[model samples]
Target chain A: MTETWIILGATSSIARAFIRQEAANGSGFLLCGRDMDDIAATAADARLRGAPMAEAMAFDARQPDTFAPILDRAASLSGAVSVAVFVGSMPEQAAIDADPAMIAGVVTDSFTGPAQFLTAIAPMMETRGAGRVVGVGSVAGDRGRLGNYVYGASKAGFATYLSGLRNRLGRSGVHVMTVKPGPVDTAMTWGGPKQPLSTTPEVVARDIARGLAKRRNVIYTAGIWRLVMAVVRAIPEPIFKKMTF
Target chain B: MRWKEMELAGWGRALKSTAAVARPERRSALAGAAAPAIGNRRSYGDAALNGGGKVIDMTRLDRVLELEAATGLLRVEAGARIGELAQLLAPRGWLPAVMPGTGFATVGGCIAMDVHGKNHHGAGSFGMHLAEIELIVGGEARPIGPDDPLWRATIGGLGQTGIITAATLRLIPAKGRTMRVREQRVEGWDEHIALLDSSDASYTVGWIDATATGARLGRGILEEGEISDASLPPAGRSRKVPLDAPGFALSSPVVRVFNAAYYARVPAQGRTVTRAQADFFFPLDRIHDWNRLYGKRGFHQFQCVVPPAQKDALRDMLRAIAQSGLASPLAVLKRMGPGRAGMLSFPMEGYTLAVDFPNRAAARSLIAALEDLAIAAEGRIYFAKDSLAGAAQVRAMYPELADWQAAVSAADPDRALETDIVRRLRLRDPA
Candidate 1:
């Protein structure tokens, strides 16, 4: 079967790099995001960058009904979706102190909504007995940092949920991967504060492509994040809470 | 419900996270199809697991078939333990020249990894000793000689080429039961290089303390030994590890103190007449669950060979590790011989370093830096001990990868003989 990547939030810079990498590696993809025009432009750019095939479609992660039809259309056009990258999410600190409406949108769009999409798509993949689902999480999930605890909590919940999904699906040949990127220069974080050793979107994209090829269960983008968060998580909670990170 | 877990060497110990399978007295009724034919599971990667495939449990196939005392050659079953080989051959004044640190590894696993020992600087890998291999291919039994393409693939082939049933290994005649040994301390990275150049022995190795930073970057103990016919009084009884110690027993503090003591114990002048068996083979096997001392995260054994021209790169790697603040107490440096005919063989006529580090998150970054340093220096990482190297890096490192892949494709067009390592390296894919 031809490998097809269905990348959520394809307009995002990291997703763009991933599309380019997949294309370079000879895989086809359907790019999804909120802005059809923006995604279309991005898809064209990806095709020019050497993606074998690229298409753009509008997607609203908060709306559960939007996924099945998109996936069905993609399955009809392509052989089957060999991989799905859930890169759609609200920004960290974007929902903090916001109204209930915004919080619900952020939570559902970031965690709950993607979980439901995976649940629906998983059965289709399970029947075929092979597939890879990747969730673009954040290093913020390694621990609840004060600056982005709300977003981190969502990612933490999703990461834990994916772990269970992976264990359950292991025997069935469906692989689930959680990617925790430390800091990526993306459309969402364009004007955000900088981090030491922050990586470019291309690096994250290349990592995801490599991770998929290796069937890695969890990938710390840029590799150094593995060590960085190791020390971060090892800090005693008593002392951790007292200091501002 | 869990049994204590001890590796073949008896050095590392682990509390059994799961129950140990009861060894059937003879081959079980379920042997052929029910269980996967697991040879010695010393394959550092997932070469042993066949997913839902039945495991053959070949560890019990321990038997030495033939020994030629005059020529120092031996034919053994795939499941025979290396320790048994040393025991059987040592008494007869012969030894398997290319032996891994642990004597518990099986002949099949050794060939699968194409292991190299201290004397690799002269003897090359265990594959060089291979005269022939008997294997089961497509349910048909066949014997392959060195000329066969499958033979090259089987050696350092990581068991994916085929199931090795038996092997004909060439053994070397040993001088005696003891060796003339020398231990010295090198102050810096340059001194370490000088010591390797100065040493004149059958085997030479440096135990580096990579934690020493700045001008003392590679300060550690250096040892060289050569087997001799001169017999001296025996040096006590061989240590036996009957049981595993507690899991968390090898704490950081304990390791540091041990490292300090080991460095302090290095004799400025040479010491002679150490038992060859105790000195060269299975020294760490005396303690069990030694790996568990690193705790639950497990550990990675990072080993790479640097070309002599890129000697400075090796020094830079040690310096980077020291500056990274991640200490590896068990770092060993040795001189390797010329590359063998095995297409994927790991050694070259240069220096090789094997270090074990507790798998901290920083392990990825630290190993990446080291790998990058090695790549820049025109060196290659050992595939047998690698867990983090990507397929791209591997392709960049091994130029003969295309030939190996072509051979594998020719042997098994369906790519049926696949392992996690193969998948990780994308070895089945066309170059």
Candidate 2:
């Protein structure tokens, strides 16, 4: 049976790496992203790498119109349809602080935008009832940090939404996995201070594959982040507020 | 485009640079991004380094864009790896015409170096098989072919003419994914050369024991290979060198013992085996970061080719390397054809010798001595493997350097593409 992955934010480093791995396994792809050129390039790469079928389409988290075409395309394709959401934005804390109104965009890019799309596709996935949904959240969602609490809060909200979605979909045979990755060496972390225990997108992609196979919910990549985040979440609010990462 | 500050080095690790690097996954980001585009950083010396400057890492842009199986023509982005291409196409009975010792080498690097493969005597260098080249010139992408005036300079041009973005290569068809190899022990220098000259196999190369002296000098194994539909087991997982090995790990005594065991493994009567294509072509690739075995200080590879008439000079060079007791176990000898696409291409209708030496004052002097021998024998040292060659010595070796410089100067008038190797060799300056 053919398995088509409807990948959102397809141009993200982690998404690209994940697509390559899945392509080699003969899975097809619907690469949806804002930059059609970049998505098309990745689609071509995916097809050449062994994907049975790969196509590119426009998608923007902030735009609802863009979401319908992708979901419609997924509906048109036969066989099992999976979705992987690798969408999110992280503007610098200083930049967000300068214009407090930027929080709306952050929430849209990270939380509400993807959640709305998932809600639209949830029924279709439940009807078929045999596929996986991988939502890439950040470890920052485990608890708000002093550095960039707004971005963290957006991811926290997204994580909660995925949790509720998983609860609703588990009975229908559709698996929803929430991936909490630590700092990945992507464009977002390129010029920043060396992040502790930072891993590559390829590593995170492999971890997601492993987690999906085990039907994991809310897994931390690099595995060590699970314990690290546990320690962070346990700290009292009084002590945590005084601390800075 | 976000430019990140990074400290990078070539494979040799002897020369390093801190540069602002932009890694663009999209082709659109390549325009007006940076100069002296680099891929994989597989070059052993300064060819890939741009100290205190800016560079665009092209590895992320790699993709197999198109393929015409009937014509055996494959179009790929410049950053695509040769080994990956081989792995992808070999099952379909096709492969890149030329692959270097390491599979990690990128197509752009292969064109810039005009790299030769084990089948050099038959297929020639990588550029000879190229049908089309797409270069980023003057902030715009331009497609050119072999008939273009810039062809000679761009191939083996050390990436001086322009930033290579993509190419259409005429890939060769393969009979199968397995390589049927024949191995034999060559007892001495003369016999080794004679055996290589007599061999008519599709692929032929000799592994030299650089530590061998006197009668055993130049003694090693000669491997001849041909593609066949023979079944072979899957390859094992690759192992990586976790850290820099201690100095004693590759000392003279240790190398001698390792070389001896490696030679003995082939046996006196020799053996025939069916091996994976990658295992036959890129034996060292199974050991990731093998350079770390040379220790923290790193090492240098001296590769030079001399005319058939200067065989005695090569023998003397080998004798010197053997006597120095500084040579690493990684040594290779092969006979090359006179097929070269670019003016500065390293191939000649003669014998080529390559040996690795741990970086030390003694090894440095030995390499310098070998460079002089190469120049004296009317031979040229490979720029891809050279880090110590003086400008005057290198200039004397490549007679067509003037022609290449003229073409490069016209293509990149601002000299914005000049790399450390270009500056170090003074390649574009007036003689």
Candidate 3:
């Protein structure tokens, strides 16, 4: 069946990589993001690469008013519809510490805003009985480290929410994949030390597509991240608090 | 490879450098980065490296902005791979007019190096097909076309002019998705150069065996290719070296044996076959990270072009390569037309020879000797494949270096976009 993919936060490096792969396969893309210019560029690229349908729409996760129009546009298409969320933002830990109000925007950008949109479309996916939903969490979500605990907590919350959503939607033949990526060379991870074992956005996109194809419930990019997080999660609070990475 | 101090190298990986790199995916971010922009780094040398400075990795910004079927024109982001463009346009009966040997090269890299391909004898260098270049020079993005003096400087400017954000390319009609390649085994250096000079095929290259001695000094495969409508089998799955190989992996004895085996694999009886375009264009790409096959230290590619009259000098260099006993399996000889688009461009009406050797002291000295031979012949070594030539030697080779430097300095007064090769060779200064 022809698949239509709704790419949220389409301007992110990971989202851009994922859409290119999908476009090559002739899948449609509804590129959602606040940067209309960026989204329009990606849409044009997708169409050039042979995507059956490529369009850009304004989407601010904090605003629900922008949700229904995108959903309505996606609903007009006659095909299995899937959604992949790559929407998330992280402020400096110190910035968030200094201004606790920053936590609301982070949670909204990373979790609650995307969750609300997914919640609105869950019924459509369940009714179709074959659509997939991919939620991108992070290795940070596995165990909150001292470096960026607030951002970690938001992703952690999102992972739990995706878990419950997966359980609820699985009965109707809907599949949900939670992707836990390590240090991906994306704009989000910009301005840091070049990661030792970091994977590219293209690699992350490939892993997510592979996970969807295999119908995996949870997957970690670079697979090594799975082991890395395992060790992190195993550390006691006393020892972890003393460590900074 | 983004926003971090990472050790990197050109495809050769012979000279390593640490640079803080920014990999921006969006077009808007391309101009804002305070660094020189680099593509796939296909140059086999330090041309793409920045050493202690910062660089902007432009691979992810690859997106096709515009395509004109009527005019056979394509505008793509600087990061777009040429292979992807070929795949996209070939199906539509149009392809990039000038594609380098490796399709993994990006538009930005192609323009920076002003690369030449197998069909260079006919199509000229990559810069010849340029329609316009969008360069972020001195913090402002501007379009430079053929009429502009800066155009020639930017084409082969080695990213010294500024960051190439997007470029409009002029494409040609492609007959099909396959290349009809005919392979003939040449017996010696004389026969090898003769075949390269006389071949009428659109694409011709000689795979020289650098380990051969005396009579068999340059004996290897001579490949002549023509674009064909016939298609071939799809490429097979790629094999990857999962880990770093031991130092002895590409030892002298092993390369000798491997080169012999590779040359013999193609029968002396000669054979003609159709191949997937990529198979013919990027012969070694199927082996992912094949550089690891040489182990972690990496390898160096020595490429130089000598005038047609300097065949004796070329032979001397080949003899030097043969004596070193350190040559890798990759070596090629081609006859280039004088159809170059930029001032510092390497192509001239001459015979160009390229050979690879693992990064070792002996190999370095041998390459240095070959570089001196190229200079003595008044022939220039390619900046794209050079990691060893000194500034004075490079200056002597390209008489137009002063013009290029003046244009570059004007375009980037602060020199924010100068890469390691530019700095090492001191291309920005004529004196």
RMSD values, in order shown: 22.7, 1.4, 2.8
Native interface contacts kept by each candidate, as a fraction:
0.00, 0.48, 0.76
The DockQ figures for the candidates are: 0.01, 0.61, 0.55
Model 2 TM-score, 2 decimals: 0.98
lDDT tens digits by residue: candidate 1, B91-120: 568888778887778998888778888777
Candidate 1 residue spans exceeding 4 A from truth: A1-245, B1-37, B51-54, B229-254
lDDT of 3 by residue, B131-217 (tens): 999988777788999999789998888888888988999999888999999999899998998888889999888999989999899
Q: What tens-digit string does per-residue lDDT give for candidate 2 at B123-171?
A: 7898999999999877788999989999988999998888899999998
- lDDT, model 2, position B74: 90
User: Where is model 3 more than 4 Å wrong at Cα?
Assistant: A122-130, A167-173, A191-198, A222-245, B242-251, B295-297
| Error of model 1, residue A194, in angstroms | 56
> Which is the better candidate, 1 or 2, if ranked by lDDT?
2
lDDT of 3 at A42: 89
User: Evaluated on chain B only, what are the TM-scores of all the candidate structures, in order?
Assistant: 0.87, 0.99, 0.97
* Native-structure RMSD, model 1: 22.7
The DockQ-derived docking category for candidate 3 is: medium
Proportion of native contacts in model 3? 0.76
